[model samples]
Target chain A: MSIKLEHLNYIYSQGTAYEKQALRDVCLELRDGEFVGLIGHTGSGKSTLIQHLNGLVRATSGALYVDGKNIYDSSYNMKGLRAKVGLVFQYPEYQLFEVNVLKDVCFGPKNQGLTDEEAEERAKKALAQVGIDENCYEQSPFDLSGGQKRRAAIAGVLAMEPEVLVLDEPTAGLDPRGRLEILGLISRLHRERRITVVLVSHSMEDVAEYVERIIVMNKGSVMLDGTPKEVFAHDKELEQVGLAVPQVTYLMRGLSELGIPVRRDVTTVEEAREEIRRLLKRRETCGQAAEGQ
Target chain B: MLRDITLGQYYPADSVIHKLDPRLKLIGTMVFLVSLFLSHDWIGYLAATVFLAGVIRASRVPFRYMLKGLKAIILILLITVVFNLFVVPGDVIWEFWVLRVTRQGLSQAGFMAVRLIYLIIGSSVMTLTTTPNDLTDGLERVLGPLRMVKVPVHEIAMIMSIALRFIPILLEETDKIMKAQTARGADFESGNLIQKAKSMVPLLVPLFISAFRRANDLALAMEARCYRGGAGRTKMKPLLYEKRDYAGYAVLAVYLAAMIAIRIMR
Candidate 1:
């Protein structure tokens, strides 16, 4: 299902001294089956915007539609909306409480009204999809290693069979290998399930590598929204908002400045590598032609 | 929804009450609470109400915010009112079966409700204006004489300060956990009492675990900073009474004397 936020605004602790506008007229659309990365500085309202997709937070003065249904409407099915848009909160492992990992994963599906057997089936499938071994399924979630617990917690949300998955910093606090594993798992899921995925992250490199589109938030509004190359092209603007282009984008820009004639907007290492190779090949052909001359 | 809780929350403001020594506010709140129980008459209540209103105005905290703290004790308030209204024997003003609303009962209930409300607001005024650290400092000093009797006053103060400090953090944690569980489709709003209570499992388990984790982290952090039971500790901003604090003490004393005079005259 596609998600659309129209002029959405959210004010926390409204009418009080501590009032803060966490989201300000945020207008965006999440098209079906697209992997989108949301990057923002801390307190930039990225979390607030994502939470609106599933009716977790009602906009203070705007509207949200999920698949053409106004979620804020009194008759809206919030539970159904939540089921369709699985949100994996940061450090989701803290939400685990069941005796075993398998049971914990089943919590979401069961809350969705699935029978024990059906919930278990879906839970097992989700665990396997996240690469959790069957042997660890019966162990307590707290006993699992940090990475494994994270995956298991994610499986709990996956068991709900959401058409759209919103993850807030899924790879935060993980080791290098763990980060790669989690990102790879998320990319694989996006590819196989054809689900619209919204990943909120601080790592610009990871976002550039994995997501098809990027949305940058600053002070509670979308500062930039485009393909990774298009977004990263505004490197100075990103930096002004306490964000940066992917590391490879910087290297590509540095290379172009040094007169290497590489594409300045390259966002990934692979793209940079191919760009340099093509430039070298062109140079070689030009050199041979000069020798013939 | 959890954020609606205002108990023990400090409302930051620059006002005479906020700047007064925490010791004075501490003693003042105690005196006010004692005065609340000093008389059951409107004259006494009138004095207390005026005093509380004056203090709240001096603190510059919005009256609505102070009243928010009363929301948590609403059930207790209702229980006390109901019991006082019906159980006290007096001339009957209204009667239905075993439930009789007595003339004296009516006054008693009204006074009890007022006292309960004043008690909450009066105490919250001190907390709302004073920082937890200052309050603990005042408490440690006020209770210092007991130290000679082997009371671990400083340690007790440290614990109180830590607990006060964690109130907001834990409330924030609870809010996060609730949202996380809600995102997972846990229905905390619907269903029968049993089901509603059952839904709390997802929220409470995470909250307790996170709280314990945080406590452990805090302990490690404190230990790393070489904290050794508040021994040989000097205040970063030691408590000092200002001219306004002396004036506050005089006002408290006058309020207390009025309450006592009203009780004795009655």
Candidate 2:
């Protein structure tokens, strides 16, 4: 297993009047090189769970083992673990603070104890990988566009060369174009770099298009974990938890209800396009065969 | 994890104290605070303690929460006790290098600690019972006379209330920034003092940026809603005193009288 959580429970402000049970006995094991999409409504413990993977938030009652080491154990070096599992927080642009874009991206590699040359090299490669222009490197990170700033922030984490990358709502609060740019960059990074990615998002379409495995969270527990095709099949149950499958999935299901022989498991536009094309070709062949008869 | 701060935080509940007029509650708290320092003997402290306990029980806020406020002040309490112990010259009981513990110092230290405790608890009870909104309203009303001196009392109260409301939001933002930095291998705990201070640069820079953004958004929102100033602005729920407020004042008067009587008898 790459990351393991056993009966993880986290209660915010425990024993106080404002005590809130944010996570409740969550047990999950993520294997190596798995692209997992964690989907949930607000306050469903999705952020809290990803924080545990990198040891940012400790499990209140249970054990979390990252790469075969119990993170909460006293002897375990959490700093090394943090470097091993990079987390890009929500609105990551807000976390970009260095004077220049290049320097900001170098923060992670430098913090990981890399020498100046090596850190600079890693930062440059990560920035290039995220498609930030070289001319923008010397400009202040605060001066970058929203999407560029977000990319720079991601590059900061990418520079750390983490084994597993966890991002929370990476495309939130962006325009359609900016959203596509950032998500495409992340998808490319996952595809080419083969980094294990855990994307915590509310956008079912984004999750459906990208991830192989989907974990549905509700009320601080994992309600469902399966392939996107399987998880999105429980449309009514997901709706009860204030969530839903992708719009394309709903469209395919609607087409089937209208007496079209379309597959309901279709999630992405490409998948729906292929299925509809196949259905039309089958009809054309059946009509030709009937005429031949 | 930073959200556990209950200091000066209002505890929502239905009780006699919660129902009293904010103006009366503010004035009562002031009187109680002043009366805490009026007594020099143990009898005075005892009377103050009894009055506070009675008010706390009436407020219906958990005593445990009130005491939790004391946790944040433990260092200040210790410093005051220690400073008072070593500085006050009197009948010396114990002496060391540059430090003297005297009978008067001991008694005075105890008095100071109790006075400080009573002060904190009294103010905490007031704040716990009254919300930031009501407190601002009460402050503006109580300081209305200062407007004649061109003090901008309403604006000041508005600023105070706004700052109070943003404290928790900023703290949560700060916690998020800290976690983001930590996830990037920023070491906040294991560093030396200087290293720790330097590490905070990452957290603070982001927090300040977000705070400014939030403030800008809030200002735009207020302006868009046509919020000009407090001039000629009337409260939606204007402050009004019911019979219970008068009764609360009468009880406060009796408590103050008991405190004065105890001081005089000693």
Candidate 3:
């Protein structure tokens, strides 16, 4: 489903001493089946914006339209939107309360009014999608390691079969391998299921490597929104907001500054490797021509 | 949703009551609570109302905000009112099947409600004006004499203060867990009593887990910092009775005397 936010603003503790505008006139639209990256530091309105999509948080002002329907209106069914737009919160494993992993994953589908058999069936498929083995299905979710618990939690949201998945910092506090595994799993789901995915994260490398469209927020406003290549081009501006471009982008820049002509927007090690190889080939050819002279 | 709870919250304002020594506030709250119970008639209640109104104004805490704490006890207030309006024996005002409304009952219920309301507001004023750290220091100092009798006074105060600090945090955590479950379509509302209780399983399990995790982390952190049961601990800002504290005590003593005198007049 397509999602559109028009001049959306959200203020926490409104009219109180602790009043804060968490979002300021953010306007954006996401087309169907888009892979989008929401980049921001902590408290940069990224989480607040996604929460609005599912109606978990209402915008303080402005309009949010999900698939052409105004969400904040009284007549709209918020539960339906929430079911369609599954949000996997940060540290979702803490929400696990079922006796077993499979049962926990089935909670969402059952809540969608599915029959027990159908709910279990959907839960099984979701568990498999997240690479959770059957052996772990009957075990207590608390018994699993951190990464496994995270996957089980994701499966809970996946079982709801949402058209759009919004994950807020899914790989936070995980080790490197676990982080890559979770990211890879999410990307695979997006590729296979063709669901619209909005990944909110602080890691520039992950966003650069995975998503096509990048939206960066700073101080409760959309600072930049474009393709990853376009956004990273303004790395200096990102730095001023306490954000940075991908490590590979810096590596490419360093290579270019050292007299090697390389593409500076390369975001992955593989892309950097190709750029370095191309530079080396040109250097060797130049040396041979000079020797011939 | 849970973020809205302002219980035990300190309102930062520069005011005379806010500047009072926390120990004095604590003692004053106790004195006020006792006086509220001792208050027998409308005169004592009036003295209470005047005293409470003055303190609340001095603290600069919003009146509407203080009333928010009353929301949680509305049911108890109603029940007390009902019981007091029917149960006490006196000249009957109204009669019905298995229930008799009496003058004494009505008056008793009215006094009970007033007393409870005053008790809550008086204590809330104390907490609202004092920061948790100051309260902790105040508690440790006031309860210091208990240490001579082999009581773990510092530890008790530390635990109380920590529990106070965690109230808002745990509420936020509970809210998060509730929202997580709600997103999964777990209906917390629109359920029968049993069903509502059952639905809370989803909320409470996560809350407990996170609470334990936080407690574990805190214990480790405290131990890492060589927190050895508060022994030999010296305060950076030791508790000292300012002239304001003495002045506060004088005001409280006068208020208490008025309360007792009003009770005698009735």
Candidate 4:
């Protein structure tokens, strides 16, 4: 129900001329049913860190524990660990390879030792959850539209019934509408299932609106970790590491600097709008009292 | 784990061999390979060995790095040596049930092993020193005469260079696809040989689709830029010969002559 990383360090091509320290002492704890957004620029070790959530990539030094069990141990069940942590990679649509969409979705559950009938049932349910119609189930996965193919790929992971779902830029390369659709689908999945969701994204606005907590990474280390409001409050530090606060937060800060006496920590447009309305109402009430006196 | 491949990898350096004209290097490699076959005795092999060593030293690429490329062909090297050791008939030096070792067999095996090792090293020296771009340009120029007979020399060179460029890219893509499937509980390991291959189907299909998609996009991009084959095409870094290239040819000529002399003496 929890994944904890302690002093994780990963080096690419260790002992070779091309050796690179990709992760440097990254420590994090993701508990059950927590919606966390991992934000970092390119090559900030976001992908590498998430791969360790499961047993896909081993850390050069450190302990990775899943549900209080040390997964880095030699005797750990890597297959079971993978099933517990379902990861959807960027442009996951390319991983779809079965003759039909339903079969592709069944690959994960089948690999987990499910019977064909059971796998099919799970796949069907997962597909429906992703909003893919039953009619598209028997069609070739390649024939689906880009968004549908991506959804089918996500279903392939969801069929495993994982306790933790880690998605790496799941909405990348999609149009604005497709982006919203994918994000909404992920938000709904997190709410209904209460699963630990680790969303790795580049879009500040999307991360601020969706996740309950935010973790900012810089050069393979955690730069900031807190709720959206707490993390966005360190706007200057975030910008120094090639990242920016959400657009709404910037607008709110600008209004505060202009002497509007509004909160500067608003992370979403809705919050900014409410703050402005409150400020205007207070001013109007004060003005009426002064005129009557 | 897929990054161990060193074959066809270029080693950048500021050395005479790296700066030599690509055409000269190409011809020099060809001559060296032909000389390896022409040599008939140990004396000839000794001369070839000395020449190869000198060229490798001058290339400035680490010897160990060059030998890494030979790891892929070690099995083939062993098979050839073993075949020569038992198959050649001559005065028997040792014998067993259905296995006999002869002086001629022993000599042949020794010669075969040396020739195979030297052949790989010779080619590796060329590829390691020259960039793929220069190699393709050299190939096109060397085969330019074939265009008179309508052989599409430029197109062939273009295909080769593109293939070389895509090797690393395709390796990266394969790694990503494998990880994606593994994250979904796809067991690539802990399976029998057939079962393991069956698991690769998920990896292969997506790879092929992406490769074709990339190729299609590249073709469209090229055509959009008004690509029209080899007809009157100009080069950005045209091939030019220098004093060092002349010196390289002279060295190649001397080696070939020595190899020919050894052949005639036998």
Candidate 5:
């Protein structure tokens, strides 16, 4: 399903002393089967924007359309809309309240009105999709390690089988290995399931590695929205917003500054290495010609 | 969602009330409350009201904040007023629909409502002025006598202090959990009573489990710090009753005596 937001604004605690404007006229769209990355500094409206897609937060004012229907329409069923767009919030492991993993994973599907058998079947499939072992299905979710609990929580959302999966800071507080594992699972799910994935993260590397498209937000507004290469090219803008480009991109920029012919758009170490090798080959040829002279 | 709750919100300010010894303020608040209950007529009530108004002015807490605090207890104030107005029978002034509006009842209700309002405002002023750490320190100092009676004064104070410290932490945790469940298509709003309660299972389960885990971590950390209850414990900031405390006590004594005199005259 495609999601579109137009001129959306969200103000928290309206009419109170603590009122804050969290989102400001943010407009964006995500096409079906697209792997999109959302990057922003803390308090930059990334969480606020995603919450609108699932109708978890109603727009204080503006239009939100999902699957060609106005999500904010009076006749729209918000619960059903949420089922279509799954959201896995940051630190999802904290939300595991069920005694066993299977029961917990089935919670979302059951809420969607599926029968017990059907929900359990979906839960099993989702667990497998997240790489949770079948034998651990009946184990207490609380007894599991930190990463396992996080995966179980994600599976709970997956069991609902949302067409658009939005994860907000999914790898926060995870070890390096666990973070890569979770990111890999998300990539695989996006590819094999053909579902639209929206990954909200602060880490530039995570987004640079996985997403085809990147949407940058700063201070309650969209700073930039384009393919990863297009957005990351504006390194100065990202840095001004207290966000950094990927380390490899920074490295490439540094190389370019030193008069080495290198692609500034390189986001991965492998890409940077290959570009460096090409530059070295040209240098070697130039040196041999000088020696021949 | 949990972030909207604004209880025990301390507004940090540099004022006389904030600077007063916490123990003095604690004792002074208790004395004020007891005096309010002892008040029988408008004179005693007026004395207490004037004293509270002075404290509020001295503390530099805006009148609007006190009014906001009063607004929270409006329902209870109304209940008390209604109960006192109808239940006490004396000097009937008017009657409508089996409801007798009497002079005594109306005055009694008015006095009771004002008294209760004052009570809430007075105590709220204490909380508003004092930080939780200072409040706990004051409590431990004042309730030290209770130790002889086998009361777990230190433990109770420690619990209160810890709870106050964890309020923001738990609120952030709760917000995260709610968001996690909301992402999973959990609908906490726009549902029937039963459905809404059922939906909370996802949010509550995670909150409780995390709380338990936090408690475990806290216990271990405390143990690592060599915490061993209140036995032989020393305070970093020792309590001292200054000349102002004596002056405060003298003012309270005079106020109490005048209230007693008013009662006797009545």
Candidate 6:
């Protein structure tokens, strides 16, 4: 279930005037059950790097291994690899083409050569996993609302039951509530399925809240790889690369600079609130000691 | 798979041919193709060849590219040449068991090959120099007079424009769908013919679905903007016959007349 890339380099439109070196030599790995957040500015090779995981875009020169199998090996089965590493593209709903929702969600499982009955069962379960009602199964996918379409598209991949789920900006273009719902669904899937989740996003706050580990990319290379707290500690360097620490982390750092005795590593509002409460209690005890003296 | 297609491919450059009015270039290509067919002898072919060479040089499109375009149709060109050489009865210059090579046959084959080559080179010059949008605009302007015969010239032009616009978008969509299926372990390459065709089902299903979706969206978008199809539609950039265009037409007319005169003389 783990994915590894060794010395990956990608050059787009190779040998053409439009040739762009999208990814430099980069090495990274994601183990099973780890929710890794990949953050980078636009054109920082974040998309190119993730696309390599499933062999969507083969590395111009490098090696990619999934579950101890060399993906680029001539003997490897690409279609099977794709089934194992399910990549939900950005705005995947655009890829939906079936007349109805059920058929569309069954597309992947059907391609995997499952019996029609088996595929239908998988599709139903997958639709449920993504929180889509069974009543909507017979309706046209096109008739669904934007958020529902997004969910159905995700369920289409989930139907394949991939061990490694790589999502590219899954929450993009959604309203605030829809964004939260999708993120919650993703977190639940990661927890219940124990799937390796690689979420590519630009929002530091979203990554900080959900992902246990963060890999920051800058200009086609890995800039930092650590826990959210460890990565956010280099706020200045992150800012230099057009990235920023989470707002809560920023606020904590600011309070620490003013001698507020708050920890600068807090990346969420709840943690910040608890830290402030603890500091206030300590201050009260110190004030009592001064009065007693 | 779709990305490999080079249709509407424009090589960006600052050459003189690139600066010429697209309408003029389109007409020039038609005139050049006609001359290639009208030429009856080596003298005529040589004259056309020199003229084509001049156009190619001015356009600044690499000669190798014109050759590449011809390479795509090499089989058809070869068939034409062979058919003319072997099938046409004439005074035999060389004879084999079932093969006869004659002076007239050789000449006809040579002329046909030259004509086919010139036709490809002439049109490729137009594509290489002009962008797809400008080429469609030029086509609409050139065919505007067909409206007198009740032909839907404007509508056809609009369709052409839309089709051209969708080419790149469809190509990009195809690339995305192919990659998606490939990620799912759909083997597109290294399979037997049946396997290959089977693999295409996933790619095609997604591609066709996206294409229809795009078309539906585009239609809705057009309707939202009150697009009423070619009726009383005003152009943002109206087509005007400039002095350069007239001069280009004059040159083409002279070339056509000269080719006709050569045919008659022959």
Give residue B150's error in model 4 in angstroms: 2.9
Error of 5 at A194 (Å): 2.7
Off by over 4 Å in 1: A282-293
Pairs in steric clash, model 1: none
**Best of the two (2, 4) by lDDT:** 4
lDDT by residue (tens digit), candidate 6, B129-192:
7888788888888888998998998789878778878877888888787776555545678678
Q: Against the unseen true structure, what C-alpha lDDT does each candidate score?
A: 0.91, 0.90, 0.91, 0.91, 0.86, 0.85
Interface RMS deviation of candidate 4 = 1.5
Worst 10 residues of 3 chain B by lDDT: B1-10
CA-based DockQ, model 4: 0.73
lDDT of 4 at A187: 96
* Prediction 1: B-chain TM-score: 0.97
Model 4: per-residue lDDT, tens digit, B1-266? Answer: 56555666787788999999889988998999889889868999999999999999998888987788778789998999889899999999999999998999988899988888888889889888988899999999998899899999999999988887787788889999999999887767777999999988999999999999999999999999999888889999899999989988998899999899999988
User: DockQ of each candidate's interface versus the true one?
Assistant: 0.83, 0.76, 0.81, 0.73, 0.53, 0.43
DockQ-sorted candidate list, best first: 1, 3, 2, 4, 5, 6
Residue B199 of model 2: what lDDT?
87
lDDT of 2 by residue, B166-216 (tens): 876888898889889989988788878999899889988988888899999
**Candidate 1 overall Cα lDDT vs. reference?**
0.91
The Cα RMSD across the true interface for model 1 is 0.8
Error of 3 at A44 (Å): 1.1
Which 10 consecutive positions of candidate 1 chain B have the poorest summed lDDT?
B1-10
lDDT of 3 by residue, A81-153 (tens): 9899999999999999999999999999998999999999999999999999999999999999999999999
Name the docking class for model 2. Answer: medium
DockQ of 5: 0.53
Least accurate 10 contiguous residues by lDDT in model 2 chain A = A12-21
